[model samples]
Target: MHPALVEEFKSVDAVIASDARTAGVDAFALSLLKVERQARRFVTYLVFQYPCFGRSDVPALRKTLSDSKKVYFEGILRGFDALYPQPLEALIGAEYAHLKARVDEAELHRNKLFHGQLTEESLSRAQLLEFVVDMRRWCELLCDAGQQELGYAGFGSSSFTKSPELTMSASFRIQMQGLADYDAFIKTVLRRPQGQQAQ
Candidate 1:
């Protein structure tokens, strides 16, 4: 819902679509969709639990999972390249580089938080809140990116739809309860005063 998040979603959508079109395959679009979905599931878990944990603590966990996902996706791309070596070769190279950079950034953040001895006081609550918002926005952007890529892959306007099947996955549904728990925790935290003494 944040303006910055909205802008980021738009940017990711553009990138995904552009990348897919460049690769010229439905498989790439599908794989990106799966990656986006998984990322969303992880982020939603983090955001929902933001209140109970410190910012420094969450980044390490997130970074670890993100790094794993990046590796999985890269391998998937390589497999796709092996199957369709010509049209997708060049596109895979560029996309792999971009994805690797993102994974590296995530690792850097994780290291800063877990290994570099950062403290929660180093970042204000508002800043941390913004980070949560950004993470959610990134998930949305990744989804949009998949859609855009599908379009570029020549899926046609008819492929675009708002069906439950398109918008929701079983994995997403299974994680919804966990996300709800996280949201409840955040609400409880927000209701309390920042410096009020605990009973």
Candidate 2:
């Protein structure tokens, strides 16, 4: 029900519809389950990677990702927004719902962590590992979604196969690199303090 989730859901639905069309499926049934799964994967990754993210930071992160998602969705929506009209529009709507639910859930989980209701034991190292793995998976999914949309628009897979053009524009590459930096930061935090260095 959160606006962030709503935006992401819409973006993802647009992406899937775009893919299906490109794949040449005529009557694809929009799968809310799949969209929900994708949304969960994304939120889980965010929460796991940035447990320290505060309410103040949530808006910025949500805004940035939402804007990115919208740009990508619009790009795909441009050519096929009218084709198969009903399904395309439906996909967009569903994605919005999916993302909204995800953002709401994530905010709740984040609040729990912030309030000390959650503990490291409650979210183990394995969970953190899984979160990173899922993050990579979601990134791949987003990339694939873009590729699929392009494919639907008559561009071959190759068209979308290269590194995302958006990722390189205007120091976005630095932002992307920050994802890795964040992982290192987490690892550093998990380590024993230098004063208590392990023998």
Cα lDDT tens digits for candidate 2, 1-199: 3233344345444644565433211111122233334433322232322334444554554444344322222222222232222233344343545444443343344446547677434654334334333333333444344334322211122111223332222322112234344333223332234455211
User: Which candidate has the top score in TM-score?
Assistant: 1
| Residue 118 in candidate 1, Cα distance off native in Å | 1.9
TM-score for candidate 1 = 0.26
Q: Could you tally the backbone clashes for each prediction?
A: 3, 10
Report lDDT per candidate: 0.36, 0.34
lDDT of 1: 0.36
The window of 10 residues in a row where model 1 has the poorest summed lDDT is: 151-160
Q: Which residue pairs clash within candidate 1? A: 17-148, 17-149, 48-182
The Cα error of candidate 1 at residue 95, in Å, is 17
Model 1 per-residue lDDT tens digits across residues 131-196: 333444334443444343321211222212232333232323122244345344233332233455
Off by over 4 Å in 1: 1-107, 119-121, 151-199
Candidate that would win on lDDT: 1
Estimated TM-score for each candidate = 0.26, 0.25
